[model samples]
Target: MEKIFTLFLFLPIFALAQKESIWDLEELYKTPKYEETDLVNKKGVKSIFYESIDYKGKPTKVYAYYNIPTTERPENGYPAIVLVHGGGGTAFEDWVKIWNKRGYVAISMDLEGHLPSKNHQDRKNFEGSGPSRHGVFHDNNEALQDQWYYQAVAQVILAHSFLRGLPEVDTNNIGITGVSWGGMLTSSIAGIDDRFKFAIPIYGCGFLNGTDGLMGQHFKNGNQAYRDNLLTNFEAEAFLPKATMPILFINGSNDAHFPIPAMMSSAKAPKSKTYLYVEDGLGHGHPPAWDVEESYRFANAIIHNLPLMDIQKTTWDHSKMDFSAVVKGVRPRKVTAYYTFDKGKWQKRRWNSTPGNIKGTKVNAPIPEEATAAYLIIRDVKGMSLTTEVIFDTSDKQTMK
Candidate 1:
């Protein structure tokens, strides 16, 4: 009886310890074992394979492309970035060059365990590749160490550590950005890896079950057990509350995969300051996703201590049929209210914008009758944009005034 009692007493402690050690930050923060490779020959760009956490009881390697600017570096070292590619994308040399030209050291890695090839889709996996992504929740029943999401996050964290160890890289100024699925990973990492100076997650946010995308469908139709596993172990929502770094959540109002509601939830999850940039009709793809100027501006603002655009609060006056937002930081050159009267899935809803009246720091616009939801977009004089949290009218009667 005493032995059993003692075991029960320690069970909760054991469980807590196990939960806290999920990513093993101490181990992941260490410089990973790596080997340089010459498979790709883009000028000034170097490719390498870094060791990551074990998978299915075997070792794994993550391929990456890194480059430094030819321009003079700061005394503290050049600010660096780790780029995580989305699903169906690989380590892109062009992506690295874009950052290198901007005078920032950059590294982009293939999370799918593929080698650099002319054809990204047909690239072959090198030996010791970790598990490829099967689906969002396909491997929920497997042990955490054997799951694809777990492996990918570990590899990204490893990449951050690798970049931090570089002699010419500014460890304190390193940031991360991921597009699409990679964006989802960035959202999760933002909460887990507080080492990043800032994070940009494009077209990716948590609350997958709330979206109309494949992840949402899977979460809704999946078995209760698997769903529970995903929510507990893999969902970005589960980890975002712990984020302590500034995060910029970028997405489109009509994004097919990650809808506005989910992105709002992710933006609100972080305790640290967060900004949003939900474009009116932004398309989903690597180029389109990364092409947003707000991303670069936000990263620059955070890394260089420049002012960032902040939307303080948004309110809806039903009686007046008006929506208003309080803006701060970086004077707004334009403010617009985007609203939708249609009330089905977010992706299919048509969005229309109306010019807002800006007085002092407040911007106001008239809300359309029967409007189901609305949000404000504030563009600064520099052409950078930021958004307010989305507001929804959930009443049975939609018509106001």
Candidate 2:
């Protein structure tokens, strides 16, 4: 074995050696139009001001706001999640009050041409169902490859990572959640990065088809389907399925951009560890659903290591869940879990004391062991409990994974 140091020595940019960042916070943040941007620091929620950062070869600005939590959290690392808005959605993208009030820091950025902050829906009922209906995209293709869109993505991700990097965020439990376009970014990034421990993509996911809204349209420039082949030709499906983190998929039955079958099949998450919502009615809009509320609930469930959430009207009943166990705890480190219901040929789960993963919320392996049966299990892991069982087809249920 040999040790190597001073990486990227052969790279052109590395030769010049000047640190480069992908955020620009000076355009609107420093102006009066953004003057009313609400922010909360030592003070309660106020307005966003301005920030200057280097973006590629030019001076860039980010209109930003800060909202400190109300909880008696320590200053050394409070858990936080990033809130990204959909297309045509800007900074101060409403419903932020809900997050700010819950003792969590929430910041929103404008993802369109760094466009003005007008025409924002905020916390109000959403009327747009897709990007076309969202009413903005004048600079659509202007900032594509590592320019506007990716820059904004990096900025938002950097902002969340910044929170973790801050003296006020818990890096161990940092999470990311977004809606519509935000959801697509969330899924895309969820696959791209390993920093997040939990993720929620509401009205998001399903990029298999090219017509997906938000940023996908930007690449189209009126020729979307062609780019769709470009994407498929490049075979980008390898992205999301590579993610092993616990990701929740919050969606409606009628979402114009995402359909149930496509979303379910396109998602690569293992069944046991995934969260889902398949409700009827309610297309792609945020109202009637407030997706923020879903984000909050899922965030709390994972960040605080609390019980399963109750926000979903649909049923992922425990009767259809099965399990197996692996003994991985190293003696002194241990946990004791009990099953409340049993099903299939196997009435038990792969219950283990493998306390290696943070929160231990990720479960792999199939549920049932053989053909047909029914039972349920209330797994009480260190006082945290959740139920899931199997109703039929128990064959090869335990994967020993």
Please report the candidate that would top lDDT against the real structure. 1
Model 2, range 1-401, lDDT digits (tens) per residue? 22111101110100111132223323212222224433323244444433323344453445445566777885555676777677566555354566667666666554442432455543222111111222322323443322344455555655564455456667787777777767767776665556777877777664433333333344456665534432432112334655667777776534655543234433433222665554434456545446435456667777777666221111112334323232222111222222212221121222222121112433323322222322122233333222222222223222100
Q: What's the distance in Å from true for residue 155, model 1?
A: 0.3
TM-scores, all candidates, are: 0.92, 0.55
Which residue segments of model 2 deviate by more than 4 Å?
A: 1-56, 74-76, 113-147, 210-238, 269-272, 289-293, 307-401
Q: What are the Cα lDDT values of the candidates?
A: 0.81, 0.45
Give Cα distance to truth, residue 24, candidate 2, Å.
Answer: 15
Candidate 1: TM-score? Answer: 0.92
Q: Write the per-residue lDDT of candidate 1 for residues 124-148, one digit (tens) a residue.
A: 8888998878876588768878989
Candidate 2 achieves a global lDDT of 0.45
Q: What TM-score would candidate 2 get against the native?
A: 0.55
Off by over 4 Å in 1: 1-19, 118-120, 396-401
